[model samples]
Target chain A: MKNKLLVATRKGLIVFQRDAVSKWKVIGAHFNGIPVSMVYEDPRDGNWWVSLDHGHWGIKLHKSNDKGKTWEEVEAPKYPEGTLVKEGVDATLRYIWAFAAPSSDGSNSLLIGTEPGGLFRLNIQTSESKLNQSLWNHPSRTDQWFGGGRDYPGIHSIVLDPRNDQHMYVGISVAGVFETQDGGNSWMPKNKGLKAEFLPNPDAEIGHDPHILLASSKQPDYMWQQNHCGIYRTENGGDQWIDVSDRDGEAYFGFALAMDDEYPERAWVAPAQSDEIRVPIDQKLCICRTEDGGKNWNTLNSGLPQSYAYDIIYRHCLINQQDELFFGTTTGNLFYSSDGGDHWEALHQFLPMVYCLTWAD
Target chain B: MPKVSFTKALKRFYPTLENKIYIKGDNISEILDGIEEKHPGIKDYIVEENGQLRKHVNIFCGEDPIDDRITLSDMVGEEDEVFIIQALSGG
Candidate 1:
């Protein structure tokens, strides 16, 4: 089994091989100074897929069959040529925030979520990417959806139902959660209970900002989201949502969210001060855990920075796989916990600002 | 023939992208073309689809930066050294 953590950072990619529960050795940094938004390792072939976003040039996708040793550019998602470009709307891919291949089934199809708020499905058989025009051209998107700090709307989280690959969920900043039941042919907004206080209409169809979205790996009906306003949970497959943020509301405004596979009710989040501040609350960094389905939240800060910790945790930087939770901070600190979210230990510090983290199981 | 060398930073992508590569070309364009032919995906990093050098990439022929980036028609001799440098950008 491959026991490694692939950490995508602002300037490059770092692979950490686990030596023990507390020991992780840096394998090396790949793509040196290039920005790598996310890295996903193909399980069947043991190949690697990386989403590279150049600050000035644009976005590209690369595939490395021999792990990270060598890479070759592959077909990336692009808008159909001759498309119109507007001030707020985008016609082409600007950055790749998320990439997910369907779970189970040997199909070589890939789902890519990009900035400017677009979702695309690439069928390897045809070797062509088809934009989900339904979501892009949705009537409510143009007027309702707003930009985040990037100043262009984007899909930041993608979750494919492990039990049913056909059911997919995507989280778009300043837009909210979108679900596609009939593959990518159609989409619908699933933000019934989430809130976006910034918008004039608090319950608008679109324009809700969901920082991170996760579907329970074991329970197809369970879903969780850490949003711009607060954290939410849905037990009825997104038909409706409930605000289950910590009652005390210390770090309620955070981007990172993680769900435990063994216990569907157990989850984790790292809250920042607020949308404007974008730092740990009170200058202390901590991981908030919910054991009773968000009824109450407990702060976990044993091994984390306590004071003057002005780091922001990106959505994809916090990951939980096989009962192991990993944390990647914007300040380049990495931590891991084996005993749920109660205790943690530092794995590495002083790496590049982390953009994404995924475990190679 | 002008010899080509890539910045050390590029070795992270391809360990084989060593410094100081020997290629046979009379101009900067052909020299890069030859290098891409030898090293498959390096050209995409250095040049755009419009055939212009990438914004972050700069090519220096001997002691001077290549002035004509579009055509890459800058003259090169048998003993000239071509350097591909990654331009410093925002922090």
Candidate 2:
């Protein structure tokens, strides 16, 4: 029996399976300098999708039909330069930060969140069709999204309604959530209650830096995010958001959130470095859980150190493996949750800022 | 001479570089040059294009980060060691 785990490494996609205890068997590795953002294996199809840095390998996908035996690379949809953007600005898609599994309304597709903020779709064509992308580019919106990390929208996390795939939501760093009820043809900002930590007291800017944003396949509407200043949740399709920060005696706001696959309401998050002033809030470098959605929160620091970790965590980097929740902190510490986010233990000592973690068979 | 060593990250790429040899050099320059002549890419990765030690790359003469990043001309007598490591990032 091979226990496998998919790591979305800075290098390409690496499939790490244990031949036995304490031994790792990685296959079809990609590490020649291509930074991979997220890698997820579908339970139904037993396939792999690896998202790479935009400028390097945009919306790249890799699949393995054979039950974890050998893997194949997906031929991504390539758009010739000068087709979309005008001449100038040496732009190379440099980052793809997040990925989400598609739902029933589509071709069991894959959602890719890219740098400079944009959404992309991957094709799950058929048995004969090799792993490749059919749709490469989708604008963030029709009227140009208000404010992203920069001039354009850069996506960090994408979520789909478990029941209907057409209903989708995505989070753009330094901005807000965008929803598309019509299967991504057009989009609009879904953020109504969300707040931008970096936003000036006035309204000079319209966006905030997103540390981490997660939308579980199970509970698409129940989303979580750790932003530049606080942690928040929105149950009504980003129409209304709640500030779950500990600053006001409410549950401590976190930057890293891990939503369960089957249990959407139950999610995990961790206290991250916030603002230049205060000591790291709820900053145990520990992952906490909210059992009844984001209404309440608790700290799960058993077997975990109480010392304040220095690095800020990106929300999508947190994940759940079985009942266990896992996250990579800024200090290069990888924590795993066995009984949800209640108890965590260090798994890997250090790796280059673990951008994302995903489970496999 | 005091024995210096590379961290686990360094050992991964160069497994042969274990606690095998120890020598004293008059200066850090001579010591690193001697190492590069043996391990080609190691020095380049540790030292930057401007000939400065990369932030992630570190060295110690027993709890000291080699006094200076540039002036490696300090003499290392019969009891100095150099330790290198991967850049540490995150909280």
Candidate 3:
């Protein structure tokens, strides 16, 4: 089990360390009073990277080589000059949504997903970044893609196949999923079975909002996504997707999703009421788990708030390490579960509005 | 030469930032370049990659706000006091 947990919050990045007795406590806090959009631990080299959303200043990126003690700011990825979100609107870096290390074995490259739907590849050693032109120039982006909740479409999820780093998939708000085979030189839409009720054409080739996408590390071909309209799963490398949302329960709409690495048939989702009402179902907080590939969902609410709770989990908040799970909410509540989703315990309830959670060494 | 000052909020990131410094430039753009030379990477906080002033940043040339936000073409006098202030916003 990881001893340290990094909580990226609206106000700062909080580091929690597990003591000798297995009790987690606040170890340190960095970037206080600043919104940390994302905190990523590079698996390759243990470098801590944080993306900051300075409300007054522009977006900034920083990396820490000595855990959370000291940090060095790196040049944030910038959209190329003359790049347009549309015909007249110039593309700017609104937010840094996601970061992924392409290789876990001493690779110096990192992939970043940003708002305005630009994907950047950065060299950590050189502090140089280049925008992936293939995805940016996708023709459907101009006509079919638009924002879901934000003002502009954003790339929130980047999943690289464990077997092949070059084969990757990115999830974009209001733009469905796109897959690349030859290291991002080209991409193709992978939303064959997704449904977008908000769009005029429900079966359009693009414009599907996948709130979060997760691919199993054990079986990369199996993927799961908590979509805006419903929950979906792909068993054959995204050749087609299957709608597995719980029609009779509250699993149809939500953002956070966690999948079992060894068992693709098992997954978890923190379900909200619906799109219009972004609260827990029936004012009760429960985590729904599926053991048989979304055929049935079990509501796990042993130690969770059952009434009058209004905590919402962001897409990057819910994560799992084997049977242990951790999640942070927008209401500044953090919870931990030692035995999957069957039970949970509040770790902290007074941190900043938690944006993302990741386990580190 | 114009004396350029920054909002104290910036000291959180760039702690060594002086209260004010003299820079040699004839316009806001050139002044920003001179400031960047003195304190590396400080200019990005005020302006964007396209050289447009960030939406929430304001640059004042003496008594008036800079007119040209894109190119920052507002001229600066030798004795001008250039102020880079973060706009009042956010919760």
- Residue runs of model 2 more than 4 Å from their true location after superposition: A1-3, A11-34, A53-61, A67-71, A77-92, A105-109, A124-152, A200-220, A248-254, A261-265, A277-284, B1-91
Strongest candidate by lDDT = 3
The deviation in Å at residue A174 for candidate 2 is 2.5
Candidate 1: lDDT over CA atoms? 0.82
Residue A346, model 1, lDDT: 79
TM-score of chain B of 3: 0.97
* Model 3 whole-model lDDT (C-alpha atoms): 0.92
- State the TM-score for model 2: 0.64
Can you write out model 1's per-residue Cα lDDT over A297-351, one digit (the tens) per residue?
A: 8888887888899778898989887567889989989988877767888788887
Which tens-of-lDDT digit does each residue in B41-86 have in candidate 1?
6676677544667767889999799998877999899999999988
> Which ranges in model 1 have alpha carbons more than 4 Å from their true place?
A20-22, A85-90, A125-127, B1-88
**DockQ: the better of candidates 2 and 3:** 3
DockQ of each: 0.14, 0.02, 0.81
What are the models' TM-scores? 0.82, 0.64, 0.98
lDDT of 2 at A164: 82
What's the C-alpha lDDT at position B18 in model 1? 71
Say which prediction, candidate 1 or candidate 3, comes out ahead on DockQ.
3
